[model samples]
Target: MQITPDGNIVFILPAGPLGSLPISATIVNTWIVMTILVVGGRLITLGMGPAAPASRWHLALEILIEQIRKQIQDVGGGDPGRYLPFIGTLFLFILASNVLGVVPGFTSPTGSLSTAAALAICVLVAVPFYGIADQGLLGYLRHYLRPTPLMAPLNVLGEISRTVALAIRLYGNVMSGTVIVAILLSIAPLIFPILLQLLGLLTGVVQAYIFAVLAMVYIAAAQGDEPGAA
Candidate 1:
């Protein structure tokens, strides 16, 4: 029931060799999540025969991959295959990070503003990366001018503002949920907190979906088209 906004620092590099470098719980938990995903993914796809009837695990994986590919195709327009890996990874990572908080003794790395900002920054960078890849540099930058040259500064501001909004939106939602549950546990019965935790899981999944969708939308916009537009 301890509620500190920024997570506890679990390790610090000694100042004897270099200035002290502290690593917080958020970074540690992120590494844990990454390890889980990599190991789990490898184990799940270890063996597969190219046959008519696939294993249940393989079937389920295929379905998930198909759905993600379809969503990217529908939302991002140009070659879904190109964006699938990044978008799919983003969704899965965020979803896992969000749900990890429900485990006892585990706090979601995403609850920290720094983590959220980092994720948002990834999307911010990816938007231009994909855009520049799809269209040439001049073509991608041309969008900034839009209807006229006067709108360039406003467009730049809009990009910065949206990145900030993405970070704040995710950090505020995850942090508030954690804080509320902690406060309630101190004041109310355990059953209520349990129910809230379940709801939080659902919220986490939704947030992951929203974050992924928004990222795709930004990429689509940067590529010079509206999402879902043929």
Candidate 2:
């Protein structure tokens, strides 16, 4: 099975009628996912005015946002609204990337290590961003030097290691699912792939949920021990 989405060239765009740029399937598919999200979000809010009745899509979006906020509040134990946007985007993007793979000829960006690594890097940055926001920069930095100054290196190492683990975990699950189905398709050529594809849909959703929850936990933990910080 192909390990990276780069191997799948979805299309090429002409450059000045002289040369063409070969776009990876990952980039094309990512654009598709982003467009879907942006349009869906806009539509969901368009009908969600004081003068307008709530549509089913608006209601579903509210339920989802509230559930995400509840998760943040539970983990971080502070105002969830501050953290909701980042966490919600992460969940939705990953969910869309994985679920879209269920469609014929669509390859998931999350199945590619590059996409997974980029997301993990975002989380790595977010941990410190939220930590410094909730606590002063000095206050957040103190966590790295906790107990003793010598532990600082280990603490920093832990941070990078966990981020790497996060990327690998996400990429591995999505990649393995795709690989398994491909191999099974070659063998059965018909029915088992359909069943496995349905199972994969659930797995993809679960992976998205797990990734988001873990991200919330990481950010909340970094929010410091100060009152109202977490």
The most accurate candidate by TM-score is: 1
**Which model scores highest in lDDT?**
2
Question: Over the stretch 1-230, how does candidate 2's per-residue lDDT look in tens digits?
Answer: 67568788878889876899888888888889999999989977995787889888888988999999887777777788898999999999999999998998888889989899999999999999999988889999999998899999999999999999999999999999998899999999899999999999999999999999888888877875332244
Q: Judged by lDDT against the true structure, how good is candidate 1? A: 0.87
Model 2 per-residue lDDT at 117: 93
Q: List the pairs of residues colliding in candidate 2.
A: none
Report the error of model 2 at residue 230, Å. 8.9
Off by over 4 Å in 1: 1-5
Q: After superposition, how far is residue 7 of candidate 1 from its true place, in Å?
A: 3.9
Which regions of candidate 2 deviate over 4 angstroms? 12-21, 225-230
Q: What are the per-residue Cα lDDT tens digits for candidate 1 across 1-230?
A: 44432558888878786789888888889999999989988777878667546778888888988998888888978688899989999988889999998897888988888889999999999999998998999999999999999999999999999999999898889888888898788789688799889988999999998998899999999998788975
